[model samples]
Target: MQACELNVIKYILFVFNLIFAISGIGLIVAGACVLSEVGEFSHFIEGRLLAPPVVLIIVGCIVFLVASLGCYGAIRESYTMLMAYAVCLLIILIAELSIGIAAAVYKGDFDSAMKNIMKDSLHSYNESRTDRLAWDNIQSKLKCCGVTGPKDWPSKTRPLSCCHPIREGAAPPQEFHCQDAIEGDQILYNDGCFDELKMKAESSANVLMGVGIGIAFVEVVGILLACWLASAIKNKE
Candidate 1:
C-alpha cells in the first residue's frame, strides 16, 4: 500500500477505537442502571437471568482496553502493537459470535427459566420483608398482580399495590384488602408478573443482541485495518 493509504487505514482504526471506547462507557452505564433499578430483586432472581448486563459491563471494559491498544498502535506505527490489536479483535469477534448463537439457541429455555425463577420468588415473597417489598414494587411498577394473575393470591384478595390508581382521594386500603368489592367488581391489575417480566427480558435481549452485532462489525473493520497496517509496516522494514 502507498504511504497515504497506510495513513488512512491508521486513522480509520483510531476512529473505530474511539467509537468502541464510547460504547464501552455506554455498556457500563447501562449495566449500572439495570443493577440500580433491580435493587433487591437482583439477589432474588437466578444469576443467569441477570448475567447479560453484567457481562456487557465486563466485555465493554475489555473492548475499551483493546481499543486503547489499537489507537496507540496506530498512532505510534508500532507493528507489534498492531499485531496484538488484530489478535484481540479476532478473539472478541469469536466470543461475540459464540454468545449471539448461544443466546438464540437457548432463548426459549431462558424464558422458561426466568418464569420459573419468578414463580419461586413469588412463592417465597412472604418469607422476608425484603422479598415482599420487592414483589410489591414489581407489581406496582409492572401493573401486575401475582405470578399468574390475581388468582395466584388464593385468598380472593390482592395486595394494595395491585389496585389501579391506588384508591386515591381516600385513606389507602389495607395491605391485602385492596379489592374490597366482589372479586368480579375489583379493579385489580389483570396481568401476571411473570409475563410482564418476560416481555422486559426479551426486549433487553434484543437490545443486547443489536449492540453486540454493531460492535462486532466495528471489530471486524478494526481487525482489517490493523492487519493492513501491520503488513505495510513490515514491507517498509
Candidate 2:
C-alpha cells in the first residue's frame, strides 16, 4: 500500500512538472518575440510600446525552480516537495486570475472608443477624397484629386501632377494636386491606425487571458486530483 501511494504521488509530480515546464517555454518564446520587434512596432501602436512584462520573466524563473522541485519529488517520493510544488501552482493561479480580471474590467470601454475613432479617421483621410471631383481643363488635370500611391493616380503629370507624400522613408503615393497637407493631419491618421491596431491587440489579449486563466484553474484541479489519487491508491493498497 505504501509503495502504491508513492507511485501515485510520483506520477502526479511528473505531470505537474511537465505542465509548468511547457508553460515556461511558452512564456520565454513569447517574450523573446515581443522584445525583438517592440521598437518598430511600438512606433505605430500603444501596447507595443513597452518592453515585455517583468512579471513574465519572474514567473518563468519561478516555474523553472518549482518544476525542478516537482521532478525531484516524483523521483524520490518526497511528500514535502510535492506540497511545495502545489503551493507554487496556487500562486501562479492567483496571478493569472488577477491579470485576467484587470483586462476584463477595461475591455469594453477601450473597444467602443477605438471603433468610433477609426471610423471617423477613415472618412477624413481615405486617400480617395480628391478623386471625387471632375476637372474641366488639362492644367486643372495636374491637380486631379486621387491619392498618389493608389492604382488610380493620374497616368500623366499633365492631367494632374501626382506628388507622392514622402514620410519617414516610406513614400505614400500622392494624389494629383492633393490639397495641401493639412496641419496635424499625420497625427490624426496615425491615431486612427493606432486605434485599429489596439483593437486587434486587445482582442488577442482577451483570448490569451482566457486561455491562461483556464490553464491555471486546471492546474489547481490537477493538484487536488494528484493528492486524491495518491490517497486512494494508498487505501487500496
Candidate 3:
C-alpha cells in the first residue's frame, strides 16, 4: 500500500478505536442493567442464567484493554502492536460469539427454567425466609398470587403480599381476607405470577443477546482493521 493509503488506514483505525472504547463502556452498562434487572428475582432463576450478562461484562472489559492497545498500535504505525491487537481481538471475538450462542440457547429454555425454579421457591416459601421474601417481593411487584393461582399457596397462611397493593401493609379487611374462604370471597389469588415474571426474564435475556451480538461485531471489525494495518506497516518497513 502507498504511504498515503497506509496513513488513511491508520487514521481510520484510530477513530475506530475511539468508537470501540465507547462500545466497551456501552457493553458494561447494558450488561449490568440486564444482570440487575433479572437478578432481583434471582430466587426464581437458575444460577446459570446469570452467566450471559456476567460474561458480557467481562467481554466489555476486554474490549477496553485490546481496543486501547489497538489505538496505540494503529496510531504509532507499530507493526508489533498492530499484530498483538489483531491476535487479542481474534480471541475476544471467539469468546463473545460463544457467549452469544450460549445466551441464545439459554433464552429458549428460560421460561421452563424459571417456572421450575419458581415452583421450587413456592414450595420453600414456608420453610425459607429468603424464599418467603422473594415470593412476597415478586407477588407484590407483579400483583400475582401463586405460581399458577392463589390456590398454590399453603391453605392456612397465604400471607398478605398476595393481596392488593393498597392493603399490603394493612390487615386484610373482613370482606377480602386471605384465609381459606371460598375463591369468590377472597382477593389473594387473583393472578398467577408465572407469565408476568417470565416475560421480564425473557426481555432481559433478549437484551443480553443483542449486546452480545453487538460486541461480537465490533471485535470482528477491530480484528480486520488491526490485521490490515499490521500488513501495511510491514510492507512500509
Candidate 4:
C-alpha cells in the first residue's frame, strides 16, 4: 500500500483503539451494575449463578489492557506488536462468544435452581428468621406471593409482604387483609416468586448475552484492522 493509504489505516486504528478503551470502561460499569442487582438475591442462590457478571468484569478489564496495547502498537507502527494485538483480539473474540453462548443457554438451569431454592426457603420460612425476612423482602419487591402462590406458604395465611401497595413505615389499605388471612380472601399477590425470579435471571442473562456478542463483533473488526495494518507495514518495510 502507498504511504498515504497506510497513514489512513493507522489513523483509523488509533481512533478504533480509543473507542475500544471507552467500551472497556462501559463493560466494567455494566458488569458491576448487573452484579449488584443480582447479588442482592445471593443469599437465596448459589455462587455459580453470579458467573455472568463476574466474567463480564474480567472481560472488561482484559479489554482495557488490550486496547492500551493496541494504541501503543499503532503509535509505534510495530508489525510484531500489531500482530500480537490481532492475536489478542482473536482470543477475546473467542471468550466473548463463549460468554454469550453460556449466558443464553444457562437460563434453563437458573430457573430450575430458582424453583428448588424458593421451595426450600418456603419450607423453612417459619423455622428460620433469616429465611422469613428474605421471603418477605422478595415477595414485597417482586410483587409475588409464595414459591408458587400465597398458598405455597406452610401456614394457611401469608405474611404482610404479600399484600399489595406495600407500606414503608405504615400499614397497607384497610380493605386488603395483610396478615393471617384465609386463603379465600384473594388479597395476597397472585404471582409466584418462582416466575418473577426466573424472569429476572433470564433478563440479566440476556443483557450479558447481548453485550458479549455485540462486543465480540466489534473485536472482529479490530482484529481485521490490526492484521491489515500489520501486513501493510510489512509491505512498506
Candidate 5:
C-alpha cells in the first residue's frame, strides 16, 4: 500500500472512530434513561430483560475508550497502537455478536418467562412491601388489575391505583367503588397486567435487538478498517 493510501485509510478510521464514540455515548444515555424509568421494579424483572440496558452502558463506555485509542492511533500513524486497536475491535465484535444472538434466542421464551415473573410478583404483593408498591405502580401505570385478572386477588378488591380518576362533573359511584367492586361493571380495570407488560417488554426487546444489530454492523466495518489499516501500515514498513 502506498503512503498516500495509508494516510487516507488513517483519516477514514479516525472519522469512523469519532462516529463510534458518539454512538457509545448515545447508548450510555439510553441505558441510564431506562434504568431511571424502571426505578424500584427493576429488581423484580427477569435478569435477562433487565440486563441489556446496563450492559449497554458498560459496553458503551468500553467502546468509547477503545474508540479513543483508534482515533489516537490513526492520528499518530502508530503501527503498535493500530494493532492494539484492531485486537480490541475484534474482541468487541465477538461480544456484540454473542449478545445479539442471545437476545434473539431469548425472545422465544419471553412471554412465558414474563408471565411467571409477574405471577411471582403478584404472589408476593402483600408479603413484601417492595413487591406491593411495585405491583401497585405496575397496576396504575399499565391500568391493569392483577396477573390474570381481578380474580387473582383473593378479596376481589382492586387497588385504588387501578381506578381511573373520576372526571369533572361526574358523580362518584353511589354504592360500591373500584376498591370493593366484585362484578365486571364495578371493576375499573379488568384486563390483566401480564399481557400489557409482555407487550411492552416485547416492544422494548425489538428496539434493543434492532439497535444491537445496527451497532454490530458498524463494529464489523470498524474491525475491517482496523485490520486493513494495520496490514497496510505493516506492508509500508
Candidate 6:
C-alpha cells in the first residue's frame, strides 16, 4: 500500500479505536454503577437500586480490557493483537447468546419462585410478631387471673399490681391489667415464618445471580464485535 493509503488506514483505525473506547467506557461505567448500587444509571425499571452480580463485574472488566487492546492494536497496527481480542470477544458473545436464551426460558420461573418466597417471608414476619405479642399478652393475663380483689388471695399468692412492703420500702403500687381473653386462640407458629424468610432470601440470591450472568454475556458480545471489526481492517488492507 502507498504511504498515503497506509496513513488513511491508520486514521480509520484511530477513529474505530475512539469509538470502541467510548463504548467500552460506557459499558464499564454502567456495570460499576450496578455493582456498587450507585446512581440510577443502571437501575431496574421499578426505580430501585439493583446490585449487579459478580458475573457482571467480571464481564465489565473483560470488556474494558479488550477495548484497551483495541486502542493499543490500532496504535501499533498489530493484527495479531486485534485477532486475539476478537477471538476472546467472540467466545464471550457466543456464550452470552446461548446462555441468555437459556436464562430467558427459565428466568420467569426463577422470578415466580422468588416472589413466593418473599411473600412467605413477609407472612412469617407478621405472624411471628403477632404470636410473640399474643404470648406476652397471655403471660400478662395469667398474672391478672392470679390476682384476686385483695380479699380472696392467699398470703403466698401475690397480686401482680400491688405487693405490700416492697423491697425498696414505701414505693407506690403498680397496676397490672391483661388485655387477652381467657380462652380463644391457638399457639403461635414462628418456625414456619422464619423458614419462609430463609426461602425469600434464597430466591433473591438466585435473581441476582441470573442478572449478573446475563449482563456478563452482553458485555462479552459487545466487546467481541468491536475487536472483530478492528481486525477486519487488517484483512482489507
TM-score-based ranking, best first? Answer: 4, 3, 5, 1, 2, 6
lDDT of 6 by residue, 32-85 (tens): 544443221111111122322334446556666766776677567677776776
TM-score, one value per model:
0.86, 0.56, 0.88, 0.89, 0.87, 0.46
Q: Quickly count the clashes in candidate 1.
A: 0
lDDT of 5 by residue, 30-85 (tens): 77766565534564467777777788788889889999999999898888998898
Residue runs of model 4 more than 4 Å from their true location after superposition: 165-186
Error of 6 at 116 (Å): 2.3
What tens-digit string does per-residue lDDT give for candidate 1 at 1-237?
Answer: 488887888888788789888987876777666655543355345676677777777888998899899899999999999999899889878977887788778878876776777677777776777767878888888888888777776464456777776446876656656555333435678788878876776666777777777788888888888998899888877
In model 6, where do residues sit more than 4 Å from their true spots?
Answer: 1-3, 34-54, 126-237
After superposition, the stretches of candidate 5 with alpha carbons farther than 4 Å from their true spots are: 108-110, 173-175, 179-187
lDDT of each: 0.76, 0.49, 0.82, 0.82, 0.77, 0.45
Pairs of colliding residues, candidate 4:
none
**Model 2 regions more than 4 Å off:** 34-39, 43-54, 108-191, 229-237
Model 5's number of clashes is: 0
Model 6's alpha-carbon lDDT is 0.45
What lDDT score goes with residue 20 in model 5? 93
Question: Model 2, range 1-237, lDDT digits (tens) per residue?
Answer: 666666666686677678767777666555444444332333223352232233455666676776777677667655566566677778887886776566567667655654454334334433544322221111122222222122322233212222323558775545433434332444112122334355446544544554466557656765775455445544644
Model 1 ranges off by over 4 Å: 35-40, 165-167, 170-186
The candidate, 3 or 5, that scores higher on lDDT is 3
Weakest lDDT window of 10 consecutive positions for candidate 4: 175-184
Best by TM-score: 4
lDDT of 4: 0.82
TM-score winner between candidates 1 and 4: 4
